[model samples]
Target: MKNVSRVFYITLALVIITVIFGAAFPAQFEGITGSIKSYVATTFGWYYLLLMSALVIVAVSISISPWGKIRLGKDGEKPEFSLPTWTAMLFSAGMGIGLVFYGAAEPLFHYLSDSPTAETGSGKAFKEGLVYAYYHWGIHVWAMYGVTALALAFFQFRKGEPGLISTTLKPLFGDKMNGPLGTLIDVLAVFATVFGVATSLGFGAVQINGGLSHLFDVEVGFTSQFFIITVVTLLFLVSAWTGLSKGIKYLSNTNLVLSVVLLVLVLIIGPTILILNMFTETFGMYIQNFIEISFRTAPLESDNRSWLDSWTIFYWAWWVSWAPFVGMFIARVSRGRTIRQFLTGVLTIPTLLVSIWFAVFGTTSGNIQNNGTELTQYATELVLFNMFDQLPLSLILSLLAIVLIGSFFITSADSATFVLGMQSTNGSLLPANRIKIVWGLAQSSVALILLYVGGLQAIQNTIIAAALPFSFVMILMVIALFKALNEEHKKMEAEEEKKQNS
Candidate 1:
């Protein structure tokens, strides 16, 4: 009880201080966050790239190795959730809000801004834009989640360890895991999860506000967005109170249905053929240039390096920040499955859905741009709403989009609260409702404060800064997981030999 209290209050105090400082001195807060983000990106960009690449390789290798057949839990244990429910929850928690927020906007931004490496406003630029968008939302991001979740699941279920990020490193640290080092690791995990989820909540609020303004003429500003965040925070807190199966699972399944309906509507009403063609060509291009793009570091061109830092490096950090929250939630729902099944499902299904999402919304927006819509005229938050305005049944579809975003926001927050509770309560699978409520409120408060002070840029900078230390932790986690798995394999071999001799 004392340990739990210490973790909760210490994390709470740190978050409160940061939020208060940010709210009271907006300019100073922004300057500090911005400077930290810039320093991390400039000095550590190469490391971030290498880390992501290594994670991808590790994820794929683990899925194919003999260890892949090992169940996350005891041998012969079956999966807890059905395939569809599992996929829905993972997708909703992982990147549902981000996809809705950036699907059309990112592609359009790339199209308009043009790449430093690609020609401006030409056929090559179009391909480069889509490829870059795909790259940002591709397997690399899921690979981060995959590796982290795999570590947590293996340690928790197979080894009977607590379901905490620090616990996963027990093989490396042994008894020290019960000391300050372990507590600090868990604290950093909670910090990363809070800010990462808060960043998404901030984005969701901006987009929700933009949708309301487009439909009902409500002004889009800090006040309106703050109200949106408040309302969303309440909704998600209520959902978290209901616990995972009743609140989060149902909402996640609903999110998936609504998302498919929206996708089909856009495809049927928009240029169906063109969207399909673009998807095929862009997918091929993404595959053909996957390695080059993944490892590309613009060492020769300052402009290209800046662009990479802003887009690619920033995205890597964001995904790494999200790994702890998403990974733990995934591990909770992934008991009784083999490492192979978990990795395959986590890596493939979401990536495919994201690609299709980018194809439908991104290509449709680009087509609108080609027809002189000037998508860049609107704010980034308003791009999705504006894109929907051009489709048939604009008002109804826009309302549906808002609902989807709202649901995504709730589901993501609920999952984050659950994960934070587990981390704070020493890896309890079912954390107390009070813990959930506190974390839920803290996440929303951070989002609201950041939105009020520095808007989306502040949120972005915070995520990058918070994720930097956690990225190193994730690398260590991978090493620790490999060591544990090797021991397990050797023990199994020795047991088999003894049985045969007997």
Candidate 2:
């Protein structure tokens, strides 16, 4: 554990030094920026999509009868947390800032552009746009987190390894990968997690800035960004310090409630008929074209394909970027769960809910933009603030919306703080409170600096760059997990034969 802490501290020092030097001599680091951009654009293109797709398949398979029995928890130990609490924490942690940012924007964007998967002039094409949002938000995304979590939990808790991602590979590699190689993998996971989560924190800070601007009639500038970051940082740092059972769990619960309230308000105030119709049709379209869109790899020059790249490819990469943090958080919360329960509950349920959110929010926003006398031109004029005017309960809804967004950001930050602290600790599921607080503050500081560097795009691009290597790492993780499972089965068989002979 001390070794682990030392490794993390070294990495932390390097990252901080790099950031300070880059900020001081931005021109000198121009090549670094270009390199990060190229890596994100070229390498993370299709591999992320394929990795997510594969993870979903594995989770779905585990949800069925036979394979689920191989879940790696110990016998006679009951669950530490209830299903609802666990589910909410996992869902909120996984959804993070993306749901808040895209919930109202994606459906509207799709409706304006039409579904990328649908044939032209199909009156049904617009409906499929909403469905695409749902499809992207649904089960497949959560499955990625589910597999990563299950691997960590089963191997760490049951196998008694310190609960690290590298330890999860032990079933397959035996002792070979357990030395420096395993530590390297763990470090990679940490790198991906920090950069990816920092992206969300940066975005959350921007959204917080936007909301404060709207609510308080203040200008959008340094003061607003600074204020929001300070508040959010304090909130999440406190939660992280408080530990998961009390702090993270409570924050997640609040986030879910506030999210629902805002969604319900939108549904009630907006055109119910259009939202429902669009949701149903979009769901159908997504289901019908599931395989096609799921595996799409259209070249950069294809017509209407840019839309796919902008929407689908971008989302897949974003989710991949997010995998390490969400996966690690899920692993922490998912002890005592069978593979089947973990898959269905974590992957399937959250995906369905996310789809519904995109469906409802997207359809409502789209309908207003397309048909409403006030909204059509309104949407064109206002980008992030577009959702504000479309609602009948604009003022009340804005309050709820801001609350939900803030809570979502805080919940995710708190969870990440916990995971990063655990990662840097003795590989224990539960680490010391001070370490969690330190990580939380570190995250907040990065977010603040990124805000200074021109807001969310800078942070997100950096994260995408850092995630390039780990995208391949996740694939390796998938292979390692299955290989470990196979080896475990072989060991069981060998023991059974020996017992029979004795």
Candidate closest to the true structure, highest lDDT? 1
Per-residue lDDT tens digits for candidate 1, residues 251-360, read 99999999999999999999999999999999999999889988987887555788888889989999998999999999999999999999999889998899999989
Residue 412, candidate 2: C-alpha displacement in angstroms: 0.8
List all candidate RMSDs to the true structure: 1.3, 3.1
What's model 1's lDDT at 285? Answer: 92
Per-residue lDDT tens digits for candidate 2, residues 286-398, read: 78978877777665564465565456655666677777788888877877777777777886678777877887776766666666533333322133355666567677776
Task: Go through the candidates in order and give each one's C-alpha lDDT.
Answer: 0.90, 0.70
Q: Count clashing residue pairs per candidate.
A: 0, 2
What does the lDDT come to for candidate 2?
A: 0.70
Model 2, residue pairs in steric clash: 131-282, 138-351
TM-score of candidate 2 on Cα atoms, chains taken together = 0.90
Residue-level lDDT for 76 in candidate 1: 88
